[model samples]
Target chain A: MSDTADLTFLQTLRRVLHQERQIESGTVIYNLPVPFGFRSS
Target chain B: MQFALTEDQTAVRDMARGFADEKIAPHALKWDEDKHLPLDVIREAAALGIGGIYIKDDVGGSGMSRFDAALIFEALATGCPAVSSFISIHNMAAWMIDGFGSLQQRRKWLPQLCTMEKVASYCLTEPGAGSDAAALRTRAVRDGDHYVVNGQKQFISGGGVSDIYVTMVRTGAEGAGGISALVIDGKTPGVSFGANERKMGWNAQPTRAVIFENARVPVAHRLGDEGIGFKIAMAGLDGGRLNIAACSLGGAQAALDKSLAYMKVRKAFGKRLDEFQALQFKVADMATELEAARTFLWRAAASLDAKSPDASMLCAMAKRFATDVGFEVANDALQLHGGYGYLSEYGIEKIVRDLRVHQILEGTNEIMRVIISRKLIEGAR
Candidate 1:
């Protein structure tokens, strides 16, 4: 709603994007695909 | 995944903060008013390994990372943005030499530069070419073992005061491809500096036009091969952009801190400013935006460290966003201070002024957008 809230949301989104990109490219620690709605054991 | 500073990074930041508090903050206003460059204080910072924060340890540097440098510059800027920004420019120039210079060149130049015994200036912008840097007109013609350099560089930060200049000169053709990088000794014959230019901010450091009239620079001083100066300069800008943005962040953070202090004590309408909900909301926005900018800057710095393909675009994004937000937040901090902020002694106005040029220099925010969009377009294709 506000610029502050917008930036916070954007930052969270960026982190998620970075995480997804790293996972897709196999740069992250885990090698398995992170399935949607799949909770880690 | 790392959202916080490492212990070492925090220690470095604290060290720089202590130095700024002791040596820089008290005299910042006087330095700005008198247009003084505190060479002694800078040398002291050099003693603390602040001079070569990210340069290699082999050449008397601290061998820190770009991320570490971001923390250092931001901390130093909390004392005075102008001085901190000058140090940033010096580091950029030194890094260009370390990154591209031959072993002999590095051995000769970097040692003194790392110690701040001989300060360095990056000479690229010309009277005709600010935004369009490739169009720079400074010429260097090959003459025996030396290149006869002849042209002027405009708005050089350490123009007259710096001991060496990392200069870009056109050697062959009409465009960027013909340009070559040369290290020119400050006292070289025909090397002269124009009168220091009066500027709106960053007055703590001198800004002047560097003039060269047939100054002979030895061929040995050249960085990399001829025809690659533009690439070198552009590479340097990747890190330079991050440092300048960090400086902006520091200045804004200082202003915000001051505003918080002012609001706590300064009463208005029989109530302290912090008690007002509207003003508190404004403070909230300032802190939020500042934090967001800081986080983005760290991402950019990390990208640079990892040599990521998107490093340049991310740097451009961070620079544009952080500098704009820095100025806005600092300006808002001033607004929160009311009329007191406008006065010189309050220091918030100085932060606002110093952060203004961060948007203009290091490739204007307009150029930043162009760089970002071009990358996006290219990536899509």
Candidate 2:
């Protein structure tokens, strides 16, 4: 849900695509701002 | 080309996600282990208005759009595919009844269905008729104020557990024209159910053969006219296919999420597995494919809501593509997990198993391609 206005299409694609898989050294860091809550009644 | 979801849809999706995570995720494995159909859990979900999501609000339903329902299913499936798929079946029957049933029939069924006080199942596929549904052999002879039905329906989800069955019966002639949609109470006399079927997946719900031996149903239970059952069944399937596709997307997304988490912590060659370019490429491809499938399914759902001429064809295409991609993504996610993926404790293997049937149900993927081809040929003329 982040703004992609400044990034190029390819760059935006990479960032959006790998955002969940971003790793720092041996530790895994999930940068997704959205919580696991997608279920609405 | 609009990728954004409306506020209402997003709210529904989020509510479904929260409910799934709290109610379904923690107990999915247990349900699978015991082969338990959690009717209580399902009823809780229905209390949220998903039971009759697409039905008019005037009839106690949410009156949501097909796209909105698709989004909700995807989010729910993130908790458990089997549970979500069963919910989809319930919605399919509820929608059919609301759309085709007489005003009196709606008054009798929709309130309870909307509240999930009564559960419903669809009876279209028979033992002899799977792909060729038009050739179904279930007969319903009209006898005064009631119809005596003598036939069998197979692969019915929530078969023994459902309270109402939206059934397709042969009423008049042969082929499609003879078919008529009937609402039969599941507890009717002479209506019996076979033993629960053991399947490769979808274990959270029961699948059984519904046997009708001279079951007497009132004439007033018929939906629409007598000869339009096949059309009603097909129309229901158009939305059913989208829901099944959405369930696949949710399963694959879960698998991908698990894989990404595993790759970050798991080590190989004295470094993180995700640091390798080959594995990164795989992750990238999985993400891209899943994203593409989700967006395409949204478009198909929108087309269905619009009642476009090509809605059926688009539904076929979306179901075929999304299910295929979902399976592939889940399989790849399993491979990424190495040995741990095969184990039940990790849950990756469960997603792969659950998603395998999405291609087979709601019409096989091969049938989907055939539909697309036929539509293309017709459009050319």
Candidate 3:
């Protein structure tokens, strides 16, 4: 591939890379494991 | 605070897990027994864009974040920590070049490194200096247009087989500020590699001493300014520690998964092994510890991505906690397997052996404690 195409591809990857969610001040919710024998029937 | 992974992150993790399961898991034992590097398998991973997972795509990388890299590495390590750790080392090398090297140097090396066509090795630890890296004795004296480098780097993965070595050499005086990073071609004259050192684990990758005897390297190959090599190496270690910790997490998790499967089937004097209270407690503890380690690792990785003030401390804490817990979890899994875990065919023994080194390399767990205590004391004042 040409250098320009390579540049474009990398640029796209950079954009995608930095696109991850950034948590600010809300409560960080974790889906903790359910306790043993505590499952609702 | 969002603990859930985004679709892209989850997709990356799944892709890595699938690749590790299919391409690496089956051959792990054979490769370990043969002491083979499996270059082809590693290159296949490169095809998945892992070679430059965090490097910019312009430089032929995936340009992912450190958190993404950590998740992917944990998934990959479910196959084999030895192979995954080697890939982590290579990624560290790639990141160093891209982060510290000039635009010209990045253009020259990043593409090949990102593709794994030219495997890279980081040369930092010397015979006498492992944790105390700044006191290295490798010398690189300035010549007309080149520097005559003469030194030895110990315990370097991909030592002999790699195409490039990102070497740390003493250029100025006697401290961290006097060091320099050089990108030396592996085939350079007088640049020889010692035979691979036989070790207890990590057999799928080669580790050797990189010896330089009056090797002349061009000045243009140096990364960053003079006397900044220590800084560059330390920066790489922050990420390196996380990746190694992630490897341990993956291996321990795999062992736990295997133990869970085995316990459900293999029975003792009772109905089933999992029916026993003691074994269930062990299972519960292992799962909980592994999850805690994973959570801390993710937080540390994200801190590194954000370049937070406590990033280094977080990395050290994560490495220390995760590796120790990982080893404990793997050991418990082995005990749960009874005698079968000790055998090679079961693969639990291999995981235990491989996880053993994570506590030692990339700065020992003891050194991690030192870093953490120092940070804590300073923060208190």
Candidate 4:
């Protein structure tokens, strides 16, 4: 039972990672990171 | 990623499916019409190790994981959602004792509970407190070796028929901090039950108000220390939510399957219903949505099994989405059946009615949003 449950947990993590990759690919084209800027006095 | 079920999981699902088809489906309509709580059928299920699906094996339980429980419940609900959900409630109560009760408490209660010799009910909801569970007023005054319990729990499943009630009561000051959980015997003095409520659905199981007036429960019956009853109840609900969602999945899947079979045979305007492109698209959409909800539910179940930090939030999301989808799909299937679906003989209307309450119980979908949003905002901070 524990082994099956652990395998299911691993599968869930893989699904999450797969979804995150899809989101990341979309974000690269649509949501660029902003750079931090300092005031020059 | 392995999206498919392992061989062991498939075997478990098939076993439950066979039991449901042979034992539960043929009589579900009669049971619903007669409002019968089929203890014999329930005991049969218990014999198959369903009574303590996730409880530790030492106590005569199956000791399966939450994911396995999800699969078992979903398959069982294909036969009758009401029966399957009542079993879920019983397991939740037994698990409380196994998870929190002392060794003696577990020994005294679990074996009988696991074997279905003594059915259990969970007592947390009250007439005054539904969403705000922390506001529960059931009071348990410490008196020597026993706690004198007072106040009433409303809408308790298996209230009159159950042998034991895992109850929550206030022990100290007001609010959530004062609450404590107790495993109260059904035969205890001053413990009485109200009439079985006339409900919208889930008629196969009884729902009644459990009234306690000076009911004496042993101190040993307390699940945990004072001030954590609400916590325990909430924790139990995390898994309870998953099971209920799985029940929704099964019910919807059954309805969808019926729709497919019906459309194949029932003709319209000299052509079969399935021959129409629009109807085919509708069936396609239903199947897609059901699959999506089911996969999401499995993820939440896996998170629970892994004890992930966000398991609770994921559970709320799954419960909300799956139940809503379940209801919509069942209702749509009913529509697809046309006038025949409205008739009791077709069995589609019953599934629609049964799926409706899934949105309300195990914490309302609105409350699910509350839990999910709270986690989201907290994580943002």
Report, for every candidate in turn, its global Cα lDDT versus the true structure. 0.89, 0.88, 0.89, 0.88
User: Model 1: runs farther than 4 Å from truth?
Assistant: A1-41
In model 2, the runs with Cα more than 4 Å from the true position are A1-41
User: What TM-score would every model get versus the actual structure?
Assistant: 0.90, 0.90, 0.92, 0.90
Over B1-381, each residue of candidate 3 has an lDDT whose tens digit, in order, gives 899987557756776787788889999999999999999988877866788878876678887899989988898899999999999999999999999988899999998888798899999999999999899999999999899999899999999999999999999999999999999999999999999999999999999999999999999999999999999998999999999999999999999999999999998996799999989998999999999999999999999999999999999999999999989999999999999999999999999999999999999999999999999999999
**Interface RMSD for candidates 1 onward, in order:** 17.7, 13.8, 13.3, 23.6
Error of 3 at B352 (Å): 0.5
The candidate that wins on DockQ is 2
Model 2, B284-362: lDDT tens per residue? 9999999999999999999999999999999999999999999999999999999999998898888899999999999
lDDT of 1 at B178: 93
DockQ for all models, in order? 0.02, 0.15, 0.08, 0.01
User: CAPRI verdict on model 2?
Assistant: incorrect
Q: What is the per-residue lDDT of model 4 for residues B249-277, given as tens digits with 9 covering 90 to 100?
A: 99999999999999999999999999999
TM-score for chain A in each prediction: 0.29, 0.32, 0.24, 0.29
Model 1, residue A2: what's the lDDT?
20
Off by over 4 Å in 3: A1-41
**TM-score of model 4 (CA atoms):** 0.90
Q: Count clashes in each candidate, considering only residues at least 3 apart in sequence or on different chains.
A: 0, 12, 3, 0
